[model samples]
Target: MEINDLTAAESRVWRAFHKGEPVAFGEGEAENPATGSDWGPERTVRASVLRALLLSTPQVDGEIPRLRLSGARVTGQLNLMYAVVDHPLHLRYCHFEESPDFYGSRLRQLNLRSSVLPSVSLASTRIDGPLRMTDCRVRGPVKLAGSQIAGALFMDGADITTSDPSVPVIQLHQSVLSDGFAAPGLRVRGEIRLDGATVGGSVNLEGAELSNPGGNALRAQSLEVRADIRARRLRAEGGVDLRGARIAGRLDLMRSRLSNPGGMALRASSCVIGELWLFRSEPLEGTLHLRRSRIDVLSFEPEVAPGEVLFNNLTYTALTPHEPADRRLPLLERDGDGYVPYAYEQLAAAYRHVGDEGAARRVQLAKQRRHRATLPWLGRVWGHLQDTTVGYGFRPLRAAVWLLSLLAAGSIVYALHHPRPLKAAEAPEFNPVFYTLDLLLPVISFGQEGAFAPTGGYQFLSYALILTGWILATTVIAGVSRSVTRQ
Candidate 1:
């Protein structure tokens, strides 16, 4: 790469690299300088020149060695695969003829801010400094899988689209980032995968649009983040899977619009999050599955409820803006999957933890009602009887009322029609109250029941009193047993 053989634009870049000065050919930082297709020699720089300058160029006295070129059309393949460059490369507002390949390469820093790239391949590459690609427009997939970024990865205001919908537009799966992954205002046409990735700091993706209809919009299963995953105002057209993920801080998806019609809008099964904030968001168009997930605090007061919600085995220690059981019971009832007893138990436990015993009891009563719906016809009949009489053991006062009412009815009927004596010599006085009491008490016996005999309709009345007494005893015993076990 002789100076004489270099083009005018390449010569300037070569000269500026040794002096550690940036050569800018663009009009302004906001607008692209390579907008015209007919870029003359002055605005064109061969990729070979850049490769030579990075690998073999010597630094000037009192100056560092770095390639900083702006607003230039890079020709030829800038293949730096397996190359180790110990200096920073800043090529802002540049247009590339081919995708820049940095696979398995190691660099001090790489900044391609506001550039137009066909694609980018940084798989397995190592960057000691931050890899900034803010406001860049990428036409194809950007691969960063298996890469180890020592600093933050900035992708704010970036617009990335891929021709193939099956592949992810931007993939950082299994990659390790020392700092945060900030991608505010990013727009992608395909999935953005961070599956199995470990971020040392928070992942900020505010105002991002991820559209991969009928597929995964953002797949980060098994991801481990030290801080929060803030995706406020995110618009996703497909399911966002966070299954088995571990977030040390809150998963804030406030005001997000998630839609996947027939599939799940958000699937966070088996996830362990410190706080899950899903409040004030648009009504999810699909199911929200939180099966087997654990959260320390949950704020689930959405503007409009999700179409369906699955909360099987979900455990949360606390709920924000705590409402009574009546208000929150609808969320549990939204579980489209078959009856889940554990979901009700968890809600009741949460209410009890907050020192709301009344709310907790209401939740338990609702659980019984829901369980009754799944029983057989005979079992359901028994369930209805228990519920009506004693509230399935939750309302003990109701049992007292039923018992008093039955005693009064039995006494009135016997007083109106008295029973005859079996033998006049041994018969006691015809006291209606004592006679009814003898028939009502199952284990207790009075001399009146042994001496007197009810005839005709009076006999049927005696039989009815005996049967009613036994039923009341049995139901009371069952209700008391249930309450004791629950306590």
Candidate 2:
């Protein structure tokens, strides 16, 4: 390779860097200024010289000297393997003739905004300042595995593509982004990972086009974001995984088209989010699992059909598509093949919060009916009996109704029939009320039913009342227990 000598700007920066002098390069330049003289012919700063400059350069005026080379054609590997330096190297509006290697290096800030570059490695590197790569195009992969970014990592409008389609275009697994990870309109040909990442601010991947077909397009499992996770208008060919992730703010998946037909498209199991907004985005294709996840507000639009999303044990304090009792009817109409009981319970609770007890009861009834469909005939029968008698251990009033009805019938039957005495010496004391009570309470004897020995139809009524009493008592106990446990 023919190596051209450093340009006048490069030479000036080189001298100032060595002398630890504060030389302002590209200060107040156009956002993306065009180069006139420092063009065409590339300059080569060898790996050895680049390493020496990074290691020896001292801070000028109590600040790490900024080496800004804007609109310059830079050609070099710029190898930084195992290099540890606290300095800022900004190459703004530049066109790189060669890629830089920053694997296992510790850099302060690396700003290469509005530049087109080849493959670069930032694996395990510690970038103290923001790694700003806005409006750039990467022809190769950008590796950032196990790396730590102290500030924000912005790649807005950057087109990142790679030759190897199997490999991820941008990887940030186990990386710590202290500020935020924003990539608006970032078009990547492969996967983008932030698994086990800890982001302090919002993660905005709005209008990003990530294509990793039949695989994870964006895997950020167990990611901790203090602010929102806004991925509106994201066109992901594969899927976006946020399983076990904790977002303090809203997880807005508005207008995002994610396709992972067979597998999980968006998994958020055990995730604790402030609000979950899936407005205008229907989960009609793949499974969106939110099992055991807790959110304060869950705003799913009317476009979202049931059975499209699996919400097993997902607890949300509030829900939207807000209307009255019949407002959530569209969601209830879903097939919900994988719907767990807690899903209905949560919905019922949401209705209850809005003081729509009738709607809540309807949800509970529907849940019980659907649950029974999966069970055997015997279970179905038992479920039906419990539902009718005590509203599936939710309404003790139903059990009370049954108890009162049985008592009334027994009293009327005994009042008409004057029963003979069981013992001649004992008077036939049949105060129809006390006598009925004695027969009704199988465990507790009230002494009236014992004194009277009813013949004919009254004898059968006594037996019927005892059985009804036992059933009602059992139902009431179950209902009370369930209420207590729920509380």
Candidate 3:
């Protein structure tokens, strides 16, 4: 029904709503209006009155059982600023031809369940209550700058298309996004921004297609989040940037595809991340920088395609010697295969930071060998070991263990072979007459067996044993040293 066809009473109600005033209609009050057709004008007036009331009040209690604005076309803006309501704002299958601004509007408590908005704009809107826009289609730009949302903002099976290429489909600037902001299986034609924003909860943009020809598909700058930022199966034709971001929780970008000619950066400068979970992500062509960042854990799929991943001056806080030895070496090896030296370099730095110079030297030597160049002077000891003919698996404690065992074995052999017998023939002439010189001599001889022995046979055996022990000790030491140095 057009605005001109309404009766005098209906016209008055519509004008009051357009002027931003509160209006209420009782049960069947529209059935007997003073002007126009009783049912037609009555229903129109009733709907207008309810819409105005909802827009004006801070909260709406009680229920208007059956109010319908189905398939209605709003020609002008539908501003719902600072309005709170307990009842649902049901506007299913509605169309807005022009821009409908809902800036600074607060929904205290109510679910926007299954509401359809073909085209709408909500810049700087605050929703303190639960909101659900399942199966909604937004054709225009959805600006959400400097907004504070308390409850869950779900947009399941939604489509956010951009009418203009220059405008972003979902713009979130310096906003506090708590709870969940999900848009699974959605198609977004323009870019999505969460720049300088803080998210207290998770953001799931799974199976979403973000395509922007001239702009970044997903850009999040200096973003801080408490929960995970999951974007699995997301396809971005443009680049994805998360520079200077911090995630206290996990970052799951599994099975996603990011392609851009300008390059995509996931830099986390001076930021602390919990876990970088990138499993089965497609071959990314851009650089992933994590300089001066701290990560508790990092995981990646071994079979995934190679990409340029850089980790310079990064600190792995959760790396411990007691952790499974097999888990510590794979990332470095894979990084070596991918032609990225920063991984090995950063691992070496981690060892050096923890006062493990031996391990650090080993890592440096490995890098030198992989690159086939002369190692630095500080890595000479490790470099010499790496060039040895025999290769052993890299381990630092193995050398110490082998050296101690050889020493213990040699001592036992020396003690077992040498034996001295006591004699009483030559005794000290006047020394108490109790202590005999023969007994003293035997004790002294036993104490200095190999040192003072005059017989060549004993000396030869002692030397042979010493040589053999030295050979074994040197061999084991060499193996361990080489293993660590080769990287």
Candidate 4:
């Protein structure tokens, strides 16, 4: 169709395309040119055929085909605004050196699959049906702001590169992205995802969402998304900030790597997250978890809670071997006044692993104090004994108590068996020195030995005292042994 030979309506649509205005279709505006009839099965079939032919053609610069409604090479800038096409809008193998504007237009369908456009602007464009693009290369910025996509938007296996740091490869701001938005394995040299884009439906990016995961070569600010963002492998050189984002369902980022100096923060203060899986991801240089994230309560097992913060199996290199004690960062610190019982337990375990028994015991004591109401008296005693320093201080007192107990027991036994040196009968003539020696001998031996005597009554009394003293000594030793073993 020659530009001047076109009908008035066709020329108007062409002018709108050049002006980059969104195409608005009225009734009967998309009638078939061959039969002069509205769009139907026959028109749809013809459009599909023409679209395939257009895709097959080898596109070159300044090559416009002369066939009516022909598909030819589209170089420089191709504007297709508000123009109604009875068939699919196919732009295959076309390279736009400058920006290609396709604002507001009514078409049966739009398929830019396998096309290369440096900068494509489709602002406020309305598609009655689906928009599919696969393996297309977008070298510059691709803006789809305020566009309404009734059907799905598929951009699978597309390479989008942008040199500007401020502009994203694909921008979808305030647009009604419905049904679904899928871009699996879509590589964006710059930021690939949207900033405040709202997907009225689901988003599937499985095995995609990677931005230089190997080393700290590439650095990004964040992957911001207001909608429920689901991906299997989301990697970034910087942190992943999902603050104030509401995800109605689960947010899965399994096997992802978030490398940032301050670590990552998946903060969802009031957002409803069905389930969040941050398993097997690389550690951030700082804290791995966040402060206020309302994760699913039921999804977590007893070993792990919803609000519980975990930083397990992470290896950190010390900035300096002999760094100042004050400057050294702790593996974990109790900041908030929440459930500190679990925090203390974890701290104790870490200390124990590092062979700091003293610190471990101190942590245990702090835990006891926090939960003393739940523990038994014996548990309290055990806590005290676990402290080596405190236990040492009480050893001497314990020994003294043991010795006193033994002396008391011995006194009782001797009192119960003593026989009055009665009736030394007939006040026998006694040597004062010999009597004194006999008395001193029994006292010095602590009544543990019998006196030498020929009389039967004297020998019996002496043997009883020796037997009682031996029994008392054994009882004392047994008591001491039991006390030490119990501790």
Alpha carbon lDDT of residue 18, candidate 1?
Answer: 80
Summarize candidate 3's per-residue lDDT along 42-75 as a digit string, tens digits: 3333344444545543332342322233333333
- When summed lDDT is taken over every stretch of 10 residues in candidate 2, the lowest stretch is 28-37
* Clash pairs detected, candidate 3: none
Across residues 1-487, which tens digit of lDDT does each residue of candidate 2 receive?
A: 1113545555566666644454333432463433422544333234445555677655556544556656555556678888887768776666555678899998889887877778788999998889998877788888888888899999999989888878888888888888998889989988888788899899988998888888888888888999998988888888788888999999988887877788777778899999988878755357677878999999876555334666777899988866554556445445244546777888889988887777777777677777888899999988888888888766777777777787788788778886787786876556888888887776788778778888877788777888777766776677677556655
Name the candidate that leads on TM-score.
Answer: 1
TM-score of 1: 0.92
Whole-model Cα lDDT per candidate? 0.88, 0.76, 0.57, 0.47
| Cα misplacement distance, residue 424 of candidate 4 (Å) | 33
1-487 in candidate 4: lDDT tens per residue?
3446544434443443323333332222232122222323221222322322333334344544311321122323555565544444544433334466677765556777665566788777877678776677777877787787888788888777777756656766556666678877776666543445566666666665445222221221222333555666655554354544556666666565555444333333333455566545444332234334444421211211122233332121111112222221132332334334555555455454555555655555454455544569996554444322123222334434543554454344434444333345533343323332233233353222322232455455445544543433443454456345524
TM-score of each: 0.92, 0.74, 0.61, 0.48
User: Which of candidates 1 and 4 reaches a greater lDDT?
Assistant: 1
| Pick by lDDT: 1 or 3, better one | 1
- Who is ahead in TM-score, 1 or 2? 1
Rank by lDDT, descending?
1, 2, 3, 4
What TM-score does candidate 3 get on C-alpha atoms? Answer: 0.61
